[model samples]
Target: MANIPLEDIQNDVDTIVSEWIDLGLLKRGELFVIGCSTSEVAGERIGTSGNKQIAKELFTSFRKLEEKTGVSLAFQCCEHLNRALVVSEDVLERFRLTEVSAIPVPGAGGSMAAYAFQQMQDAVLVESIQAHAGMDIGDTFIGMHLKPVVVPIRLRQKNIGAAHVTFARTRPKLIGGERAVYSKDQAKSMLCD
Candidate 1:
């Protein structure tokens, strides 16, 4: 496998996060989940070649994103931990999430998640969360952590290092059938009592 420069990894993350910011879907303080596989980023199969240095670069970019957007972050662990997430204690209390017991290691939780658990001031593991938005780097599968009615976001920057990337934003489910008026203008025209 080819060696992916750490600088490239950081640049890709920054670019992707910038696109996410431009979308304007994620609000301040909203939960954003991230699922990444450092091994995949390094041009290897997921869980085969975990790299701490790659995780560090990705983590740095994500921290910058948090500072710029004020969005809370959740780092999803690998399937070994049943895809639980690493989040700050504040996020846990704010969302009333149930705490889970585990300390993520590179082999078990994944390099990205394990790094996040260590860097966070008060990191805690949670069984689950319904995040408002999310990015999946290296096909780690963040869908289970996102809220219902997820809208896939297509970004110009599609890859982080050697891994494919996907993004999503959640919105309230549109209910009602044909009779439903979705906009204020339509409601005014209908004039229902």
Candidate 2:
């Protein structure tokens, strides 16, 4: 933590999310899976300590990402539910996603996800998903939350605190074999190109 002030964290988040958008890592209405480890932000093991302050900082940045990209967020829970995500009502309707019933707590949902749930206007827990893009903070394990094809994204900043971060966006799973010629442009378009 370097005993760094919380402001630095907030600023870092804003910078990262914006950079993610600018780098064509995400787009409007696409699902943005976030698997945050608040403990790591507080200089602890992945799930050892869920700090509200860190969650709030991350949430502020996430909201900015939401506003700028119009990307729907899915807060990935911990190993519980195999890291099933919670999405907004708009996301549920857009993707016809099923809304399970579960409210995130600091311990159960991890602080970052719980904070997102608190800030979101309309939120619902979903048992499964195929998200368009995702950021796994502290390696909360968001692979289960992504779509059929996941493309890794390398961010300018590798780790966002003590947590190791990973980002990826999905592509339409290529089904056809030798005869199939997938659109290269379509793949690039997935990242908001």
Candidate 3:
């Protein structure tokens, strides 16, 4: 895949977020997980073609997305770091983050997530989260980190340059067994009321 322009990247992201909005997958100021592999975006296996330049473009696009949508960004690091997440201190405290340690580097944390680690104002590694929505670009495998009840999202702008992109918005899990009549509104509200 050729290096995509930042503007194009933003457009793709914008299209993605717009669909989430339509689906009630995300709301203003909600937390969203993003796990991107620059190598995959460039049509290579994840971590094989880590590129800081490509990472920067995607990060910029994410930042703009956050600013426009009022959504918090939670970046999932590569498996080298045990898939730890880089989140803001505010989110940490609000979510009662469980302390963890690791410095992300190329091939370990993947370039984009590593870049997030370096760029965070007050970064911390957390074990888990229940994000409202999430993007898994290049098969970063973020399902374990997302909230339960992952629902797939289809966007018109499919591949972000050869790397398949997938999105999810979670809903509450059904606790009781049979005879439990689920509230349609309750399930819908989990994604969007």
Q: In model 2, which regions exceed 4 Å deviation?
A: 175-179, 184-193
Clashing pairs in 2: none
User: Residue 137 deviation, candidate 3, in Å?
Assistant: 0.2
Residue-level lDDT of model 3, residues 29-72, one tens digit each, is 67899988888887777778888877777777687667767778
Off by over 4 Å in 1: 184-193
lDDT of 2 by residue, 129-148 (tens): 88888888887778887887
Assess every candidate by TM-score. 0.95, 0.86, 0.83
Report residue 120 deviation for candidate 3 (angstroms).
Answer: 2.2
The TM-score leader among the candidates is 1
Deviation (Å) of 11 in candidate 1: 1.2
Ranking of all predicted structures according to TM-score, beginning with the best and ending with the worst: 1, 2, 3
Clashes of each: 0, 0, 0
Candidate 1 total steric clashes? 0
Ranking by lDDT: 1, 2, 3
Q: Report, for every candidate in turn, its global Cα lDDT versus the true structure.
A: 0.93, 0.79, 0.79
| Candidate 1 residue pairs in backbone clash | none
For candidate 1, give the lDDT of residue 142. 96
lDDT of 1 by residue, 62-141 (tens): 98778889999999999999999999999999999999999999999999999999999999999999999999989999
